[model samples]
Target: MAIVREKGAMRQWSRSQRQCGQRIALVPTMGFLHQGHLSLVAEARLRADKVVVSIYVNPGQFAPGEDLDVYPRDFDSDVEKLKPLGVDIIFNPHDLYVRESPEKNRESGHETWIRVENLERPLCGGSRPLFFRGVATVVSKLLNIVEPDVVVFGKKDYQQWRVLARMVRDLDFGVEVIGCPLVREADGLAMSSRNVRLTATERKNALAIFHSLKRAEELVRSGETDSSVLIEQAVTAISNAGGKVDYASIVDQETLKSVDKITKPSVFAITAWFGSVRLLDNVELSNN
Candidate 1:
């Protein structure tokens, strides 16, 4: 597979593929590939004639004091993992946003940002205020650079998928945003790059997050539809698991607004801290 490092090169590659009448699907990723990521790549492979996976650890998405400095990264290993997956090109841009000034906490020439407004104000958005702004801006850059027929995102980041999907529609990006099912380990922990940072004990405790969501799913299936009751149970589970709860709420899967009752399609999402690692996972709920 070809590795593309420059935005101009990527756009040229895209133009050539389009000229050849080849449909392309772009899978955006922050390296340190796991089965969850591969699953998205696999889906992309099936959807288009060519697939481009962009490996970027966006600094814009990380807030002050967040884990941007030490987020897990092994470019060589990530490349190896994708080699067997039939990826046509790996768009590893060196830097998309460049700051003219090098002063700390000083404004750079980069002043533009994209926001989904109401969609980014709940769940993970509530805690990490700057998270979605960074995500939206960088993803907008990727969509512009790659210009693929479709882009794939894992629903594991439920809020993120919704935010970007909405952004595409509102901004008229013209690329199909596909949300793949959230992948999980055999024991049910949502696969994440940060899973490597968890200590043995913390990893075992992390199962509580998924388990609680599963139990909540069971309750919803058994005629429990109250959002308050479900959210309370998720919070208590994380607390008892020795993990700190970031946010747990059942929101409409599309609008992302919290529902008073689970009368329609909704998602029970959770973000919790296991030791220093913050992990996200969610389960979709539907009464029908």
Candidate 2:
């Protein structure tokens, strides 16, 4: 795979692809490549003639006191993983690519931000205030820069995926957004780049998030309709596993508003802090 680092070079490369009538697919990531990321790349390969992956550890997306400096990154290994996936270009740009506004450009200013209302205020949204804004802004920039026919996101980041879908539809980006299933570990924990930071004991405890979501699903399937009970069971499971619970609730899948009755399909989203690392997971509970 050819690594395109400079913006001018990447734009030139993408222009050449467009000139040749090749449909392009873009996969935006924050480096620390894993199976989940590779899975997206593989999917992109199938849908578009040319696939471009961007590995920028976005600083804006990270909140204050978050792991911005030590988030985990290995560029050589990431490149090695993408080599066999037939990735046409790896757009590994510096901070300037996405944070090129006058404020960010100035030596003493902060990064430019982006936010979508209603959707960015609940679930994981409450904990990380600036998170979605950073996400939305970077994603918008990537879409504009790559100008791909399709962009792929992993469903593991369900809220982010949903928010981006809404952003694209509302803004008319004219690119298809595809959500891939959550790839998991043998022990059933959803695969995540942050999983690298987990200790042996913490890793075992992390499985509780998945288990809790499963139990919530079982309760929903067994004709239990009380949203509070399902959320309680999930919280109990995660706390029992020694993880500090953040928020566990069932909300409308599309609107993301908390629901008292499971009258329609909803999502059981959970977030918790395991040591210094924060992890999140969700399960879709459909009454249809």
Candidate 3:
């Protein structure tokens, strides 16, 4: 249960592990651990000899009025939960994007950023314009700092997983990116740190997101290949359940472009707002 808060220490530890011929896996997180996050840790544990879990709430990922200030965080609780799971190191850096100094913390002076281009332009990217740019830049920093053999991400953020995978490939990162299945609560609401912020009624209303996707799945299975029909149905269902639909898209799984039909592998991805909390969920669709 070693907790590392500095990049140099983390890189040193990563180098030491490599010297011992140990394979390392990184499970980057924003703290406030839930079962969904632990699932990623479990996958990381199985894939590599050492697991490094990062718990930094990246400010760069949030826009002007987003939940960055109020995002849930419980570092001590997170450590206690991961202790039982055999996490080798917790890379909880104070701030990875800024330069640290005693007089005053200042910017890193680097204006560069990474973008996966097309994959980030739709869905969540459509609403949160800066979201993927911030995500890609910070994740690039993490990959460079940890230097793990592989990195794990939850498919709950389907676009994010795709974006990072594309970034790793385009930038020639020497680490494998693995996306685990999206986990949900018993009632079908996708597990998220922001789930705690949902009021009782809002939580109950959020079930429509899951049901909408399930209905979309049923439609696709029952010969409804029209992408517009699926998107309309999903949007209507969520809106009727007291949630605001952000985007209900049926897009090609790889290119992430909205498709006219389910001619190839595709995913029905949805993002909606339950109260002030924005949640994402998706279902893989194929004409079967």
Candidate 4:
């Protein structure tokens, strides 16, 4: 596999692949890859002739007090994991991938941002205000730079996947945004890079997020429709399991806005603090 670290090199590599009639698949990620990321790579391998993975921890997606400085990094290990996956090129750009302009830094000038209006203000957005703006902008840049035939994202980030899909459609980016299934551990925890930060006890407590979501699913399946009661029960389950609850509520699956009554299909999203690490999980309920 070829490792291209600079923007110029990646563009050149992408052009060469296109000239050869090789369809390109791009998997954008922040480093410290796990099984979840590899699943996306595997899906890319099946969908396109050439797979390119970009490993850059985006600073814009992180909030002021978030774990930007402390986010994990292990390029050597990440490469080892990708080498066997048949990835053709790895785009690991320098700090300049997306940086504040000198003028912007000097006087707090406005940095260019991409926002999906209604979709960016709910669910995770309620807590992390600037998260999707950073995500949409970086993803747009990656799509433009790589010019891939398709880009893959995990369904674990359901809202993100939806936002990107909408952004691509609205902006007329001629690349298919593919959403893969969430890969989970044998014990049922959704695979995440942040799982490494959990202490032994915290790890045990983290399972509450999944279990509570499961409970909510069971209630919905049994014909219960009260959104308030369902959310209260899920939050109670998480707290009983020793997690500091952030928010657990049901929202319209498509719009992501909180729904007072479950007249239609909805998604239940839960976020909680297991020790100091924040974790999120969701379940989709549909009649079909």
Per residue, candidate 2 scores C-alpha lDDT tens digits across 79-177 of: 999999999999988644434466564655555566788899998888888899989998988888788999999989889998999999999998999
Candidate 1 lDDT: 0.94
Clashing pairs in 1: none
Candidate 1, residues 1-288, lDDT tens digits: the string is 999999999999999999999999999999999999999999999999999999999999998899999899999999999999999999999968875765655566688999889998999888898899999999999999999999999999999999999999999998999999999999999999999999999999999999999998899889998989988988998999899998888889898888989999999999999999999999999988
lDDT of candidates 1 onward, in order: 0.94, 0.88, 0.92, 0.87
Off by over 4 Å in 4: 98-110
How high is each candidate's TM-score? 0.96, 0.94, 0.96, 0.93
Given candidate 1, what's the lDDT at residue 184?
A: 91
Candidate 3 off by > 4 Å: 100-108
Whole-model lDDT for model 4 versus the true structure? 0.87
Ten-residue region with minimum lDDT total, candidate 3: 101-110
Q: What is the C-alpha RMSD of each candidate to the true structure, in Å?
A: 1.8, 2.3, 1.7, 2.1
Candidate 4 lDDT, 180-199, residue by residue in tens = 88888899898888999999
- CA displacement after TM-score superposition, residue 56 of candidate 3 (Å): 0.5
